[model samples]
Target chain A: EDQVTQSPEALRLQEGESSSLNCSYTVSGLRGLFWYRQDPGKGPEFLFTLYSAGEEKEKERLKATLTKKESFLHITAPKPEDSATYLCAVDFQGAQKLVFGQGTRLTINP
Target chain B: GAGVSQSPSNKVTEKGKDVELRCDPISGHTALYWYRQSLGQGLEFLIYFQGNSAPDKSGLPSDRFSAERTGGSVSTLTIQRTQQEDSAVYLCASSLAGTDTQYFGPGTRLTVL
Candidate 1:
């Protein structure tokens, strides 16, 4: 069975704090890993897609890195405006749909 | 260019009723997808349509859920005999041909009373 698990279901941080959210997966024939940001009552906004181990992508203050079995979303000195639920999904070989993690709810106190 | 769009931003219906949710994918995108998100749960894949090929319905939870894409652009997801467990946010997304990045639209919140 293919499964994706995200740790630290919820996190509260002061403004300017840096932290990392984890997404681990157990699947066969991994194809790609994706990261997204979702605000309240909205659909997820695409962030990055990592296709192979050691691959990394960045946008503004966010960076996503991938490994053979997991991925990490690192936030750098996050701002209150950056607070949102971060989602991770995996697309494996021969699969037409993505398997998503539960997501990490991040709150940045201003 | 406009991104994916869904109609009926909110829908509230009594149990046993039926409902339809619509989605317009980004212009020129060849792939469209539907997903469901419940409170505190991860997004669950519902269906996928790619160009003129048959839709991938493997992810649909039950026979009561059905979807269709017309002209390879607009899609509709219908749920029959709604149950309380059916209440959730239904999201739509699209991507370019042979691409992995999926841009999503504002979801439709469905509530069953």
Candidate 2:
């Protein structure tokens, strides 16, 4: 069975603080790993898609890195606007469904 | 639609009532998806539709939940005899294809009382 697990169920950071959230997965073949940021009362907003190990993608203060067993969403100098639930998902080989992990709730206090 | 759009932004209904939620994907998008999110939980995949091909409904929780995509554009999710546990935000997303980045809608907040 394919599974995704995210660490630090919750995180608190002061404005401008930097930290990384982890998303570990167990699957036979990884097609793509997705990162999304979801705000209250809204659906997830696409952030990045990392396809292979050692691959990295970035947007503004967010950076996503992928490996064989896990992915990292590193937030640098975060602001309150960046505070939201970060979700990680993995699409297995030959499968159309995406298995998601319990997201990490981030609170950035300004 | 400019982006993925879902109808009935908020629906408060009785437990036994059946409900249908609709989604209109972005023009020219070939893939549509449905997902649910419990309070403070991550998004859960419900179904996937690619073009006029058969949909992948592997993630549906039960037989009472069904969905259909018409003309490869609009999609609707129907819940029969809603239960309290079914209350959640039902989201719809669309992408250029299965392997591409998905764009999400605001979601329909369903409440069962």
Give per-residue CA lDDT, model 2, range A33-90, as digits (tens): 9998888888888899899999999999999999999999999999999999999999
Instruction: Tell me the tens digit of each residue's lDDT in model 1 across B20-42.
Output: 99999999899998999999788
TM-score, every prediction: 0.97, 0.95
For model 1, the DockQ equals: 0.77
Q: What TM-score does structure 1 among the candidates reach? A: 0.97
Categorize the docking of model 2. Answer: medium
Evaluate model 1: give its lDDT: 0.92
**TM-score for the B chain of model 1:** 0.95
- In model 1, state the lDDT of residue B57: 89
The parts of candidate 2 lying over 4 Å away from their true place are none
Error of 1 at A57 (Å): 1.1
